[model samples]
Target: MSAYYDLYETPSPKGREGKKSLHARVCPIKTYTQDEFIKHVAAFQLLPKNQIAGALTAIIDDLCDLLADGYTVEMGDLGFFSTSLKCLQETDDENDKIRAESVTFQNVHLRVSSKFRKRIKHAMKFERVHSLTRKQKKITSTVEERKKRLVSFLKIDICITRKEYIRLTGLTPYEAMKELNDFISQGVLRRRGAGRSVVYVAGENLKVE
Candidate 1:
């Protein structure tokens, strides 16, 4: 299937004041689940799904630990994994004080190998789709509705990632993350892993009573 995209306008940079420029962004229509990935790998490697899943889990656990320890993991032609950092706030003018305590990791960074980039770059096909306003996409469900849907999903699924929650609830990234953190705080969900390896599972208050 062709990758779908939509166009949006952004203000032109610096000197081009008041001018707008158009840019294209992907419009994903579907999300593949972990089940699909496991099935594909199992078939390709002639392994049982359960075995593949178990190994995958262990690999992820190790990746999280290794990345936390500040190791750059090289995964052959796929990519290398490392951490990235950013300041909480910029220095006043490079003369202002900015200590180590004021800096924090933004997330884990994956630098895809040349082979990996070439594979996708050669295979991608694009088609334009209608664009929706950011506000329109971000305001799909009410707070209660999102909470209900999430609880119901966790009843059948094992866990959810922030991306999955955003897709399920049509929430903006910031809004979805805030609500997820709030749910964790309220004991409705619990976070697993750190940085890029994070996921959420049902907590003591999963029933939301």
Candidate 2:
């Protein structure tokens, strides 16, 4: 099946005055989950679902273990996985010395095999979808208005999630994060917990009504 795309108008850069140009952007159809993938592969290979699932799990465990052991894993024609590191800057002082704390793990870099890259390059096809009309951007409430609303909500709920902030203010995830970060910087809100369990609470400076 051909990949589908939609067109969007690009905003003119500063100091440039001309007609806006259209850009083609991919329109995702749907997502295929891991379980569905295992089932599909089992059907084609004539193997039991449990066997295929176990093998896939083992492969992932081994790959992670190998990467953690400072080894580059080559998965046939798929790709290679290897870890990288980031180190702290050196001090200028003659007595200053580098320690284990100065180094940190960065990320796992992937290098795709030429065969897999060639296969995708030859098979991929694109289809243009109907162009979408640009809608006027919604005007969000002023900072003061948002702060008042947030304070009011905190008075009753005590805490809010990234998702809750989006629902409350009709803001995208990135915009919601920016507003939350601003609140934290202004001493109006403080974050609790970390990662997915994180939530926002009223800061010491906040005077909730």
Candidate 3:
């Protein structure tokens, strides 16, 4: 088995006029979920699926806790996990004050161990799956169209999901999310709940057609 990639034509950053270049992007053959991964580990280790899953979950929980507490976690062959932060600029003046609120924490960075890197590198192979052009038609609906549709839906339904917006507007998940978030930011819609249960409702000041 080998990793596969699809060739896509992208606008050349430095090219003149209509010039484009083909770029190879990895194309996933299949997605393996956490449950499937746990089952595979259980099979190899001769342990029950539940036990393997629980152990993996505990490791993740502990890893997050340690990272949150400002500790770097070394998993030997796997690598190290550490937290990072972004901070506001401090004035050079001696009397200037910098408080805890000035610092904003960012994502957890991972440094892959040499052992793990070598192991994966030894097994890696790549193949071209298909060629694609950047000439594909855009499927995103206009903002006015989206707003009208959303308001129309609000008249019949209480709320809408990301998936529902995709279906209604024929937009990809990424595009749908951007449009929805734009609506939220513009005060046209308000988000309710979070995660899978999240839905959108019309804002208090929104006018319906």
- Decreasing TM-score order of the candidates: 3, 2, 1
lDDT of each: 0.78, 0.79, 0.76
Task: Note each model's CA RMSD in angstroms.
Answer: 12.4, 15.9, 14.2
- How do the residues 61-176 of candidate 1 rate in per-residue lDDT, one tens digit apiece? 99999998889999789899999888998756877888889888789889999999999999887766564455444375687888899988887777899879978987655556
Query: Candidate 2: lDDT of 152?
Result: 80
Q: What range of 10 consecutive residues in model 3 has the weakest lDDT sum?
A: 128-137
* Candidate 2 or 1, higher TM-score: 2
Candidate 2 global lDDT: 0.79
Better of 2 and 3 by lDDT: 2
Instruction: Name the candidate that leads on TM-score.
Output: 3
The residue-level lDDT of candidate 2 at 71 comes to 98
Q: Give the per-residue lDDT digits (tens) of candidate 2, residues 1-209.
A: 45557788898899999888988887654445789778667766789999999999999999999998889999899999899987786678868776879978899899999999999889777766442243434746887887787888888999998778878887645456667877876888988765467899999889976
Count of backbone collisions in candidate 2: 0
